[model samples]
Target: MNINKEENHVQSVVRAAHILQLVANSDHPITINQLSEETNLNRTTVWRLLETLEFLHYVERDLPTKGYQLGYAPYRLFSKNNMYLSLIRKARPLLEKLRDEINETVLLSVPKHNGTLTIDQIDAPHSIRPINLVNRLLPSHCTSNGKLLLSRLSIEEFNLILDRELEPITRFTITDPTLLQEELNWVRDHGFSLSLREWDESENGMSVEITDNRNELIGFISLLGPYQRLSKDKMLTLAPKIKSTAKEIAEKLS
Candidate 1:
């Protein structure tokens, strides 16, 4: 997505790939002239690349109208790595929409070992929004998303997570295994978790689990922000909305 690339990045290939994407995104087949005008490339160059893509069955060219459409190659390439990609693609747009509704940073995360791993984030435009935590392993015992994941664990697995040293990441972090286990039980009973600065002193986080068609836990959708804005009570009130959005995302996988 970064247009400003390194010197080694080939311009022709990038342009061709962009054009191919443009075609794939279009609702209908596109003309060569439109592709040229959109990319600001010469008609001849666009034609050459389209011809190559068509030959490889990565593009479908209309013989009579001289139009082009996205071919099966792209779908085949992506569908092979479907599970995570499917979840992310379906979750991202909804996460952005939820960010607009609540005006808070939203995140999608999954369990990774005994921790919560953020898969995506849609940061609120507010200057005071919490920092993005995508790809980070959040502490399991003290974070809302982490506890949401841990609450779904089997008895043996739950014991394993509890057996690990529950170090305090922040002043408010629950370092006692019994207390953390009690919190997880509460989360399981209430169907949601809202933590007040257990990860960071000034921030609060809320999480709701997403389930598959079979009602199995898939991941979690979370909101993160300053305690002043996302106070425990305020987050508690938003819990239903967050769970609703997570359910909508679950429906997509079915």
Candidate 2:
């Protein structure tokens, strides 16, 4: 790749990015012809763009279905940012407020290289009990944080994760990849995720994704506590508040 030639290829790169965005925005896989028609770019140009993207793992072709979908590059790029930590710092006060309000543990998580990682938490303040979770890497398939992150992926990417074999951490945990994908679909549709004794046998967790003004998923903020104390009704009530707080934080950060 010549330097000037590569610089001149900005048009190609932009079109390729647009193609990825198109695929990501679609609820189902799209064919190359569909992409070309949608973009108003010629077939050859679109094919070249898709080919380049596929080579970089930004797009993957579904051979059996003969459609293309987003690949790992988008996830990799999203996970590489340091803004997640900065967001955590800004979220401390908010987390404290939630913890105080609910008298339950509050956590902030961002997607890491291979799984969701807890970057910050506020232990509930109370006279009788307090749960401490400062730094932990929860199973991506068995926790609320993991579900929120996983919800951002395309169907193909979600299947890729399931193909990796989701391991069960507790009896309530979902170990089947297909079953977990179904749960994730519901989570995405509902705008929140709940883990009932999934990761920890005694703990129940509820999480909502943090997305920027452009609807780009940044991370998630969650509440975790003993299952007995955080009942289903309570979780349902808190879910909207959690999601609202996340949006507020994202706006402030933006």
Candidate 3:
């Protein structure tokens, strides 16, 4: 069979790459039918391309919804890639300095789903201190990272976060959505936030936004320790330093 000029260049690999690029560029999930229409390819061809991408873990599919989304592979790739690795390396010295100054566990969190989850953490020098887990979701209504991230959200977005079931992680957890919104507003006004034994019964923390030079919300930096040791006055004293250090790190990223 004689292949036409266009057919000769219709490489499956090229088409697959184009499909993945389209999905990555979208902020929401897309369907195979949508992709087929966009690519001007038949439904069978689009499905085959989607399957290949999914097998490589670069795309995800939801059978029930019949939609596709960018998979975790891209995030894993970014996390290990040179660009973010360099950013983390540059941020470490500042994190070390902040940890030493506060004499507590200093942490950095990035927005993930409804929470600002921990991505990096440095424990207190003392051996008896509580261990803060890295890569764990901190409750949005209770932790300093959560409030600061929530404060950055628009009113509608913030409302969506509040509508979810609130977990009372501790007696102090702000389970009331109205109250949580009020606290988030206060954090916005104050430029920093404090969580005194809210997420965990014994843990207290102070958090502030890490924003780029353009004032985009990148993440948050927080100082945390046992409530028994870090008093109210001590937390107040540490807040500005945390904010400043976060700003310094954000500048490097920008």
Highest-scoring model, lDDT: 1
lDDT of 2 by residue, 1-254 (tens): 22223455676666776788898877567998998888887889888988888899988998887889889887677766755667877888887887888888888888875778777878876543324454466677888888878888888887788677677788998997768878988997889999999888887889998888788878889888888898767999888788878978887789
TM-score of each predicted structure versus truth? 0.66, 0.64, 0.65
| Residue 20 in candidate 2, Cα distance off native in Å | 47
Q: Cα deviation in Å at residue 93, candidate 2?
A: 1.3
Stretches of candidate 2 off by over 4 Å are 1-85, 127-131
Q: How does candidate 1 fare on TM-score?
A: 0.66
Model 3 lDDT-worst window of ten: 1-10
Kindly list the per-residue Cα lDDT of model 3 for residues 4-96, writing each as its tens digit: 234657677668877888897765688988988788889999998888888889999876777898888887877865433665677889999
For model 2, state the Cα shift of residue 33 in Å. Answer: 71
Off by over 4 Å in 3: 1-83
Query: Residue 219 lDDT in model 2?
Result: 81
**Which candidate would rank higher by TM-score, 1 or 2?**
1
Candidate 2: pairs in clash: none
